[model samples]
Target: MFVLNTFDIGECLSFLCFISVSLIFCFFMLFASSVLGGKSLSRYKHTPFESGIDPVGDTSLHFSIKFYLVAMFFVIFDVESLYLYVWSVSIIETAWKGFIEAFIFILFLLLSLFYLIRIKALNWVHK
Candidate 1:
């Protein structure tokens, strides 16, 4: 003989609640921005320079390719690690499927990384 309580016995700080709250916040921000900002779109709305000031520059700035490569690599690996964190959380419930899925995902990620290395995408030393 068991009696169920009115309060939730299973809800333990749901991550879905956080997601929903953040979405609501985003919607409010969008609505507020649109309402308060007003519709002031005109021809000169986004002109970078003012007063016809001639842009004084050599216009020949070349960025180091290494800088961009590092940034992109960081982003790729960072996203992969983020997914890893999420996968870890549900690994217990999902069991074998979760293990196989995460394993294959990591395997593919490593393959891509290996491919990048083989292509020398990270090699930035200028000869």
Candidate 2:
């Protein structure tokens, strides 16, 4: 088997294609395994439990939209911090370009902050 150096454009594309194919194949295999296993589909699985007590009625209750919004805000905050760590490492090497890229990244993230402010999402004052 003759190996091609990554400097060649063909080799680089092949490398990317290999990664894409491997990821897609792995995902499909995992999905197929879960679907074919089919181990937990019994009627008892649909029941809810409270302290090992019998299930209660009206389990399909609606929740406040604010609850979901708060969860999203928390996820955004955590993911944005991950980006900051990568930016810190890159800025030491690339200087101005890295700084500009990091600034742009924060600018986009600030849009979420702006939205939170507009909705008074963080306000604890009773309406």
Candidate 3:
């Protein structure tokens, strides 16, 4: 049913040429860097560098559970905001049904937030 025209063929060939050229350039750069870059490794080069700060006593540190809980709550709310944006964009098409659903979603989020607060999930000093 469909046929490729001369212009389409030209465009496809141009795309292929561009892709091939890009791949060749990337390969050449990688090869050149591996052969020429980073000569003579030293002990100082291998050491961990933190903003020119010397290596500290301990690298491992314990994080508070409240920090993780707050992070998770932030992520959950951020993702819900994305969904709300999508729903808002399609609000006209979805009409009344979309409005009610979005309202219910917001209500649930609020309830969950209240529950978390009531359970002291966000409290840092209490723990």
> How far does residue 69 in candidate 2 sit from its true spot (Å)?
0.6
> Which sections of candidate 1 miss by over 4 Å?
1-61
**Residues 1-127, model 3: lDDT tens digits:** 3665536678789999999999999999999999999787787978899999899798889997878888999999999999999999999998999999999999999999999989888888964
RMSD of each: 8.0, 6.4, 5.9
TM-score of 2: 0.54
Quantify all predictions' global Cα lDDT against the true fold: 0.85, 0.84, 0.91
Predicted structure with the largest lDDT when compared to the true one: 3
Best by TM-score: 3
Score candidate 1 by lDDT: 0.85
Question: Tens digit of lDDT per residue, candidate 1, span 1-127?
Answer: 3567655634645766878999999999999998898677788667557478755767579998788889989998998988999989988887999999999999999999999989888887646
Please give the clash total of every predicted structure, in order.
Answer: 0, 0, 0
Name the lDDT value of residue 103 in candidate 2. 88
Model 3 residue runs over 4 Å out of place are 1-36, 51-53
lDDT of 2 by residue, 1-88 (tens): 4676546889779999999999999999999998897686788797776889997677788987878877888997998899899888
What does the lDDT come to for candidate 3?
Answer: 0.91
